[model samples]
Target: MILINRLRTVLAVTAVIVAPSGGTVLAAPSVPAPVSAAAQPTAPITLRYEANRRSMLAAGIDRPDGDFLLFDPNGRGRVAQVFGDLSTARRIAVLVPGMTNRLANFWRGVGGKSYRSPAVQAADLQRAGAGSGGFAVIAWLGYDTPQGFDEAGRANLARAGAAELERFVAGLVAVRPRATIALLGHSYGSVVIGHAAPRLPPQVTDIAVFGSAGMGVDDVAGLGTGARVWAGQSDQDWVRWVPAARLFGLGHGAKPAGPGFGARVFATADVHDHDHYLSPGTDSLAALARIAGDLP
Candidate 1:
C-alpha cells in the first residue's frame, strides 16, 4: 500500500508538470533561426549598450543603472545586461535563468529576493571575480523561458532557448573575439545550455549548472561539447526530489550532478535552497566565480 501511494504521488506530480491544460496540448512557440557567425553584429560594445539602454527607457523598462547590450520589450522581453566593461574584459560569463522569469521580474526577483534575481546574481558574480580583473558577467535573458511547471517539464521551450543562446554567443564572440567565455545556467536554463553545448563556439571554456532539473543527457559525454562541465546542487534544494529520468518525452534526463554523469560536481554546502546557489558569500558562488574567471 505504501509503494502504491508513492507511485500515485509521482504520477500526480508528473501530471501537474506534463499534462495538457484544458485537455488540449498547446503548440510550442516557434524558435527563431540562429544568427550566423559572420552575420553577428560588429558594432562597438559601448555603442550597442547605449542604444539598448535608450530603447529600454523609451519602452518604460526603467533600468537607469543597467548596462544592456540587447533589449527587446516584446512579449516576455529579451535582454542581456553586462556587469562590467565588456570591451576590455578578458574573461566573460553569461548567466541564463530558469522558469517564471519575465521582464516584469528582471531586476527584482520573481519572489523579490535579490539573490534570485538574474541582474543581482550577475553583479554578485562580477564582484566575486573582481580580483581577477577584466572579468565581466552578462545576465542574459535572450529566450522565452517556460512560465510554469507544465512548460518546464517539456523540452520544447529549452530547445527554443538554445537557439537564442547560440545566436547571442555568436554575437558576443564577434564583438569580444579574444575573451574566454563561461556559460552558467540555473534550473531549466541548464537544459538550454545542454542543448546549445554542441553548437557553441570554441571560446566557451566552461559550462556550469546549479539547481538543475536535468541537462537532457544521461552523461557529460552525451553533451558533445569540449568545454569542461560543472554541476552543483544544494542538499536542501527541492529539485533533488524530481525524477531523474526522462519519461515519454515529459522529463529531462539524468541529473548532471549525480554519480556517473561525468561532470565536476562542485560544493554548494552553504547554499540553502534552489534559489540561493548564486547568493553572496556561498561556496557555490565562489566556485562559480572561479569557473567564470578561468581559475583552477
Candidate 2:
C-alpha cells in the first residue's frame, strides 16, 4: 500500500507539472519521482564574488581554460563566471539557473554532478552561437535563491536577485564595451528575469525563457526593455500546468505558447522536459543558436 501511495504521488506531481506537448519536448523529466527510501539531503551549496568594473580576472581566481573568469563570489560554492573566445565572438549571453541551483551545476556537461547545470547549458548555447562566430556566454550564478517552494511574502528573493542581475549586466557592459547580451533564463530564473526586465538597458538584444511559468507580463511592452522577447517550452514541461491565476499568488503561472505575452514563440520540436534544453544537438539548442545569432 505504501508503494502504491508513492507511485500515486509521483504521478500526481508529474501530471500537475509536466506539459503535454509530446515529442517536441525531450521526454526526460527534471525532477525525480517519489521514492520509498528516505532521501538524504546534501549540504546546501553557496558562493559569492565581489565583481568590479574592468576585469573579472583581476579579482584573482583560477580562471578556467575557456577565455573567461570563474570565481566563487561568496566562497560558499556558488559561482559567477563568463565565457567567450573574444577573438571569435562579438555577442554575449547570460544564463540564469533555477531553484536550489549553484555554480557547479552549470558545468557538469553530461554525467558528473554538473551535467545539466546552467554552465553546461551556457556551453551548449556557446557552441550554437559559435556558428555565428562572435558570441560570449556568461554563467551568472550569484545571489541567494529561495530553495524549494519558496514564494512571495516575507521577502521577494527572486525580485531582489533580479535587481542584482541588472547590476551584473551593467558591470559587464562597463568591462566589455563591445559585447551585447542575451539573457536566457530557465524555470524560476524566468521570474527573476521578468522582474528585472523593467530595469535593463537597451543593449540587451534578446530575452529567452525555457520551461518557464508566467513571465509576470500581460504583454511584451511590460517587459520594459526593447530586446526581442522569446519563449520556448517543451510539451511535457510540468510548469505549463501552473494556472496563470494561481501563479501570481504562488510565484508561478502557466505561460503558454501564444501571443499576448509578447515573445516570439519558438518551435520546440523534438524537445520535451524542462532540463533537456541543455542537451547538445537538440532542436532547442538549434533554435537558441538561431535566435542568439540573429540578434542585432
Candidate 3:
C-alpha cells in the first residue's frame, strides 16, 4: 500500500511540473528545445586562396608587370604572379630557391604538415612586422630556373639565371625606388644571389644564404653587392660535408669566405636539417630574423 501511494505521488508531482504556464498550480518551466539548422557556429577555413591574396594585397602588391599580367589557362597568373608589387614597404625579402624549385616548391614542410609558400614567407614577415612593426617580404622565383641539378645543367642555369636575377632587381627598383630589399638564397639559390649581388641596385640592404654549398667567394669583402652579407648553415647540413674538390675545377662553385666574399656566418648549433633554417624556434632562423630585422 505504501509503494502504491509513493508511485501515485510521483505521477502527481510530474503532472504539476509539466502543467501549462497559466495553470492555477505553480509549476517548473519546460527546458527550451534546440533550434533548427539556422543556428550553429561556422567551421574555420583551412586552405583557401584568400589568405594568399590578402597577404599580397597587404604587402601592396596589386599585379604583375607587362605581359606577365595575363592569367593563363592553368589558373596561374602571368609573370606578375611571380614578381609581386613593391610599393610602400620599409623592408623586403627576396627568397630565392634552388634546383627543381618552381613557384610551388617553397611550400614543402616536414611530416606532411601544412605550411605556406614564399608568398606565405612574405606574409609571415608582415605578421612579424605587425608585432614589431617595420618590414615586408616577397617570395622571388622570377627567373629562368633549371629543372634539375646535373653538374652541367646547374652550371648553365647559374650563368643564365644570374642575368635574369639582375633584370628582376632592376625592374623592381624602377617602381619602388626607396624600398630596401634583402636577397635571401637557399642551397643553389645562394649561388644565384652571389652572382647577381654585385649587379643589383643599391637599395638592396643585405644578402643572406641558408643551406648553401658555397657562395663563390674567397672572402667576405669580395661580395660585390654593397649590402650587409650574412650566412646560416646547420651543423648537420649535407652541404657542409660536400667535397670541395668537386667544386674546384673550372666550376662556378667558390668558397663564400675564402678571401673577398663578405658575409657574417651565423653559427648553426641550434639548427637541424637542411631546410629547418627558417623554421620557428631554430637558432639559424633566429639569426636570420635578426639579420632580416624581425623579432624573436
For model 3, residues 174-291, the per-residue Cα lDDT tens digits are 5556767777887777878877777888988888887776655555555666788887777677677664333434334544532334467876788766666666666665667666
Determine the C-alpha RMSD for candidate 3 after optimal superposition of all C-alphas: 21.9
Model 2: residue 75 alpha-carbon error in angstroms: 7.5
- Please identify which of the two predictions, 2 or 3, would achieve the higher lDDT against the true structure: 2
lDDT of 2 at 189: 76
Candidate with top TM-score is 1
lDDT accuracy of residue 126 in candidate 3: 43
Give the 10-residue window scoring lowest on summed lDDT in candidate 2: 38-47
* Candidate 2, position 51, lDDT: 19
Residue lDDT tens for model 2, 1-296? 88867766666445423322111222226434432110101101111121121122443434433433333334334455555653345687788777667543446532354546667677777777776477778777766665656553113767777877887777666555666778888777777888899888777888888877766666677778888889998888777666664433564433735565768888776777767876777888888877766643
Give the clashing pairs for model 1.
Answer: none
C-alpha-based local distance difference test score of model 2: 0.62
Q: Candidate 2 clash total? A: 31
> Each candidate: what lDDT?
0.84, 0.62, 0.53
Candidate 1 TM-score over all chains jointly:
0.85
Candidate rank order under lDDT: 1, 2, 3
> Candidate 3: which stretches are off by over 4 Å?
1-85, 104-116, 129-131, 151-153, 245-251, 257-262, 294-296
Clashes found in each candidate (C-alpha, N, C closer than 3 A): 0, 31, 16
